[model samples]
Target chain A: MKMVRVIVSFLAMFFVNAVSAGVDDTVWKNELKTQFFADRSISETENIIAIEAPYRAEDAALVPIRITSKINQTNDKYIKKITLIVDKNPTPFAAEFNFTPLSGKADVAMRLRINSYSYVRAIAEMNDGQLIMAKKFVKASGGCSAPIGADLDAAMKRLGRMKFKLSGTAQSNEPNLAQLLISHPNITGMQMDQVTRFIRPAYYVEEVKVTFDGQPVLTAKTDIAISADPNFRFYFVPQSSGDLRAEVSDTDGNTFSQTYRVEP
Target chain B: MKCIWIVSLGLCLGLFAVQCQAKTKETLEVQKIAPGLYFHFGHHELPNRDNHGAIANIGFVVGKECVAVLDSGGNPQQGLLLKNTIEKITDVPICYVINSHVHPDHIFGNRSFKGRGVQFIGHKNLARAMQARGGFYLQRSEEQLGVKLAPKDIVLPDIEVTDSLTLDLGHRLLTVTAHGSAHTDNDLSVLDKNSQTLWLSDLLFVEHLPVIDGSLKGWLRELKALSALKVRRVVPGHGPVMGDWPAALKPQEDYLTMLLKEVRSMIRQGKFIEQAIAEVGQMATGRWALFDAFHKKNITLVFAELEWED
Candidate 1:
């Protein structure tokens, strides 16, 4: 009887692992790594950076993701760039964030379109070229292929409109949180027109630049994976009041810029 | 004598098999809400494998010439069953299958009604919406709803209602009006002028919670305009038919308005979407069924839209 019970428990454990293994197929190691970072080693560790995402995304089109860094930005040594990738999406390269020393912290929060149940990974590259990564498995599907916007007409009417909101009073030499909201549909081009039999062309924001007093804080190269009305929350160090400005450019060659005056 | 016994036994077995088949085939149940208006009240439950995605109100209106089907059932099987039920009630050939919106529960059954002379109708934006979501809906049908579907299952509307199109169902005239972005970007409501019955599919949620796939502000705007219409009874997509015209619109209006007010305030307070989802819309939890399933998602969508408000 004891032997039978032990064998039954072992079989149950094996089944559970097999089911979970199918979910986290680890396509990143074979495909994503070779395609993105060839010959360069990326350390898969949580010490340098940690990714926060809903285990089961509430909205596939707008899954909120936050990447926090363990080390603060310093002139001597700081993280230079962070790349976010969703493994199972048609285009897995979601966004690449280039951070400067003026960016007091490397933390970033944004919404993304996750196409399937896949791993969302954020890899941080230090100024010295060392890469460290963190990832979370998100259960979501059909975000890229879902209709562009619930209110596509409304989104089109206010295309390229941008806004900046500062969370609280800025302290000099310390990281202050700011949110940048841009109005764009970020169409994935995967949607098909049943009648016309024509595929909608992909139109999305390609570049975003944020500056604090003319000093670059965060610059991001985004793709269709970025959710509609792309909203980003990041930190910048304001040395005694400055003009915070954001310039956004999309695939259609439309450029929009907005500036908010900040006081420390 | 042996040959006679064998023939008698075979006849008896055949009769039993026919009886069993008849007993197992479930027929759709519908009620006559008005003079010529028939309504099938769907149970308030989430669409699952057990229910086969037939969790929405669907019915037909009979007139002198033909019959107009309001939103079809959730799956192709339900659509077939609805067709059978309509045939049992009246010999009027189904002239029009009017789709209320692009949601699967309302439009998935469109395939079963595809035939020559039977025109499928929807809002002007319905074609675009259907095209955009058709692939995704087909991919998820088997896994999510436990129903396997092919590309032929997604039927596009032959006639589009940009503003309002009136169909002569023989003696009765049904006016199909296309509204702005409310429940969805492509939402159509049919009004039977004879019986004064408005088939506002998914526009008014009676017991079930109202889902916001479109703009929150837009839905509230639509309710204001639709309330002024003179109607004796209304049929919702999820709940029972109501005799009160505008009075029946109160519960949904209140819930939506409250969500707008609360989420807007939270945005003004410099709160995040995460915080708003957790804190907003707590007062009306037990008032509506399926609040747990859709309330948080509603909050998330509302927060994203209202946060952009100036």
Candidate 2:
């Protein structure tokens, strides 16, 4: 009965196309604005970051969002965290990612669900406690409930298969692009398992840490907005051949870790 | 067949798996739809042990100085056959290799056209869709369908049509329009202006039941918009070629609309997907091929979306 109430309320969000249901868009923005910034002063500058998604989402359930930091500063004033928000989703908060000096440029790309044609905003939290935002309007609806492509059993069985691929030949001591894939449903509580006729409990990758030679490169704190079988693409300057490690922990407290050797 | 419903799940599941070898190449037969426009008709056989995942319609359009391939065959071997067939005809340089969407049966043969100096064209989302599912499809082609994919097998679109773009095949011209997610997120339809033929490429299913990979609402909207286009003929991706445009678009529209209304009603009644799967759209089962295998999936997908609708 409570689930019905939640779904109906979510549907109302769809019907009203209310920039902010029960609150104005600016109000919702300010609310999130407060959470990410806290007491820190906010300077809305276009200098540091750009958020990119297709003007029209090809697949609502798997809309790819790419965030790039124009500034390559390593520490101190460097970007400390990145957060994503879909103003119209049933659950508006998407994700927040953290970066370290080893992460050559604070550039990362991941996919998420866009429940409706809404403004998808990405905010970067600087170490100095300043927050800046970039926004893109994504035209998509009904992403959260899109049917899972894989069988429920198979999807559950292969919950943590990991694969890594180099974008190009890793030149000695050059910034190399790497792709990491984790097999996961990234289920939001709203989804119903067709097989069992029951709602699938929310289970998603909560944190992901990428390290090169045991030194932290990047740490991503994600949420249900992340797509199933999430993929992370980033850059790292490898000094020499070393083992690249990925440690992912989901909301279910399930930790999956794998190490892929960087080919010389 | 025993019933009209074809078991298309064979191709999706690769029902009979085998290790494919380079089979003896066969010559492709192309039917002349209009002057200089030809299409290769495929069998209704499921993509199984015998067919080698080659059950979709494919063809090429010839212009004055060049030619444009509409959709390639399913596997590398079938692509070779289609290529050999083109060679047997007039020798016009292939200016464009247009993929209808990211379906394996429609794209795997792209390997045969590698290095032919042909530009592969598709919807803007084709590359991403291929990136998301290419590896799985490549693996399944071998594991389930017995077709081994080569390095150049899966072709990503070089020319992405975000809105609408036209290709000049010599004196003749063909318009390619990118429609929002219909059968798939990357469904691209071609319109040959010289001849009044609209290549609906999975947009309009003639006899075969439609598969819903993208949005059901979007697909229905597409059909409504396509019904207004005054084309003399239609070339469907999986069914019989049609001689009429709007008239031929009825059954599919009715089918989709029926599912839409029924699914919405079921959701209002608080029916779960399992109950709606059996109860919704039972009246039209005999009118379509692969109704049993894909119909429920369509219902499942559509219900999942409409259930969230207010």
Candidate 3:
């Protein structure tokens, strides 16, 4: 009877230890909850906001993420803010994009960082008191340790030369997709300088504003999760022929702007 | 029973260790990039304390009286070995030697073909870069590989192409076009007309993560243009011969496009440099294993170039 009791206890202890050895789900959950509410409150509710990205990215530092909103039912409504939070990053809040009605649709396609295998959350707020959320888990790592290609001096030479590629012709009623390619290291603080052991100071794009024919269309405010050399692809309803302008500024007092002429 | 179990475990562990060691060693696989063009596929294995020579892919085009050699291997010894291999396949002598780019692994064996009267060719920019960095490259290579490489032994390109040039090997015509700034400021592609073979140097890397010291957009554009060519075979700078030119260009093009799109968005958002690096974390996934080593560096270069104003 004593031997049987000992075996039972041993088996029970083994099971308990195995469960404890697993990843701390509560830790990640707490991190997500804390980061989502760091600046604003959020509640998980169903709405038209959706985020598209691979569940497992091949490259961790430059994962493609797309956020789209199907809330076209109302004309006056606009997305006030869109936030992407990668739960496992040292700083979970990846990016926050602010938009105005000129933004045609509450849509954005950008790349972001993933520190590890973690869940990514996209929270969108409408003009009215409505919060819509979408979540996805991605498996990726080592984004913080990759090296920047150019030397510091070389990288700063031509910092903000923008190229805009309009996907569709102006005649086509289909919403034109504009792809803006920008140049910036968007260095995250977690990376160590190759020559120096000291961690690099955090430098990333803080805000992006896109204007169509001098009218405000889209604006974005982001954090460390924004990948280097930011690329923005979004759609805008082309009313007529005009110039599309984008002005971008980083935290380091560097401002770059470019204008592309749109034709009918 | 215990002894037998121990022996079985030992054998299993031995097999596992051997498999692990084998995996670590790179496999050099050669494939036909075009009908008659071929290139070896493998990363340059940096020599250890015992190994004396480095490895690189040497490409050639067979002709009636002679063959055209593109980029020699790491050392004179490697160069001789490659020359012998070429000689065995063709009875003609190697008449023209072209250095695809100015990296040492691709140019170090220039001395081996020195006395053979091989006409050396390269981009105008390569000669300048080589001249400027020849001494430094030799010194570092000798120190790293524990072998002496004199700058005098390095052969400069006797023939320099600025815009475009052609080499008519009688039976096969090879058009050499200098594409504007890719992989490096001076990148050249050798297109064989008869076989529709395109020796793309380091322009396209298959499976391996591409190293970009040049313009990301430019390289992508170059690849796109190359894909449109009548290329039936493609010999890359470091990998196996790509049978499918368009399919081969997709991975490289996709990678660059992804990098450009991602980095451009970050710059637009006003993400600082540090944040950009952090946020762009290992962004791509699958098939390509060394994506981590090359992606970040590519991002940095792309960011710098894209942000640069005229």
Local lDDT at B231 for model 2 = 86
The all-Cα superposition gives candidate 2 an RMSD in Å to the true structure of 22.6
Query: Considering only N, C-alpha and C atoms within 3 Å, which residue pairs clash in candidate 2?
Result: B6-B290
TM-score, model 1 to reference: 0.92
lDDT of 1 by residue, A50-132 (tens): 99987876667788899999989999889999999999887899999999999999999998888767889998999999999
- Per-prediction fnat values? 0.44, 0.00, 0.03
lDDT of 2 by residue, B1-310 (tens): 5342355555534543422222334568788888888888877555653477788899999897888888888888778788888777769877788999887778888878877578899898787556545644554454335556754576778899999998888889899999987887788999999898999988988788877876688898888888889988899887888987789888998999999999999766645445676688888989988776567667766764564354
lDDT of 3 by residue, B1-310 (tens): 9999999999999999999875544232444545445465446444422233444567678777668877776666666656766765667778888888766667877787776668988887666546434544554444344457775546778888988888866587788887766776667888888887788888977766776766777787777777888767777776667778688788778777887888788766645333455567465656575665566556656665665433
B187 in model 1: Cα distance from truth in Å?
A: 0.9
> What TM-score does each prediction get for chain A alone?
0.88, 0.82, 0.79
User: In model 3, what lDDT does residue A234 have?
Assistant: 77
- Rank by TM-score, highest first: 1, 2, 3
Candidate 3 TM-score to native? 0.50
| DockQ for each numbered candidate | 0.36, 0.02, 0.03
Q: Using lDDT as the measure, name the better of candidate 2 and candidate 3.
A: 2
Q: What's the DockQ of model 2?
A: 0.02
lDDT of 1 by residue, B66-163 (tens): 99999888999999888888888899899999999988888878888888779999998888777777877777665556677777877888899999
A best-first ranking of the candidates according to their DockQ comes to 1, 3, 2
Identify the runs in model 1 with alpha carbons over 4 angstroms from their true place.
Answer: A1-22, A141-148, A193-198, B1-15, B21-26
